[model samples]
Target: MLKEELPPEAALDGPPPDADHVLQRTLGTVRRERHDAGRRRGRVMAATSTFMVAGALAGGVWLGQDTGDTVLRGTSAAGAHLAVQVTDTEGGLRLVATVDGVQGGEACWLVVHTKDGRTFTAGSWRANEDEVTLSGSAMVRAADVAGVSVMNHDRTPLITAG
Candidate 1:
């Protein structure tokens, strides 16, 4: 331990820092930190809410959906293409069928066959264009559906698929 002496020119005592200013700065820092924390919490809540809503929508879609296919596409031996969407409606089973490559100007029919050996007509239309879309419903459940077909007005099958 070596002893050292202070210079005479050096001021031994300086004025203490202002207490009020220090207090105010400390309070301001605390308030700013608190405000930042609040903003962070708000952002977290918003993210959580968004995720929750998305999960709820996904759940609703999963729970309220139909059992049949959204789309079933097939081609006939005559080269016509058939696409169908089968859904369950309150009235019964609904079928949306799109037919393509069939000869135009012919009256065509959409039919649904049930597992119980019953056939139901869905809709009919004139094949006025290269492709046509038809929609109809039957008073049968999707579980009871056997197959679907598009036929000529004379009941000749044009396209068939299950």
Candidate 2:
């Protein structure tokens, strides 16, 4: 080891210089760091929780949505194509349909058949163009539906779904 000599002005004092201010500044810096760390942790936790809630809500909606399909397709006597999909709703069976090759100003009717041999006129529409899409509900159960038919205004069966 080597020894060095100190000048007269560099002699040690009774106590360390500025010790009080140094200790206070150090403690203040540590407190600020801790506070910032806590805030960051809180933000991370909040974000995670929000994502979890959103994910759970989305998952629930997806699980509760309808997944079954009861759809039938057929060609009409007048060279029209028809598709009818039935779904169970609160009041009855909901019908969603698409009909193509409809003549302008042609009146059409939807005929619903039940397993118990009951028939119902579910809905009707007047086609104004070549293609028509329609939706309606009827007092029939989807499970009890046996067939759906699209008929003309004269009661002629245009399309039949069996």
TM-score of each: 0.58, 0.60
- Write candidate 2's Cα lDDT for 30-65 as tens digits: 999999999999999999999999999999999898
Spell out the clash pairs found in candidate 2: none
Among residues 3 or more apart in sequence or in different chains, the pairs in candidate 1 whose N, CA or C atoms overlap within 3 Å are none
> Could you report the Cα RMSD, in angstroms, for every candidate shown?
11.3, 9.9
Q: Which ten residues in a row have the lowest lDDT in candidate 2?
A: 1-10
TM-score attained by model 1 = 0.58
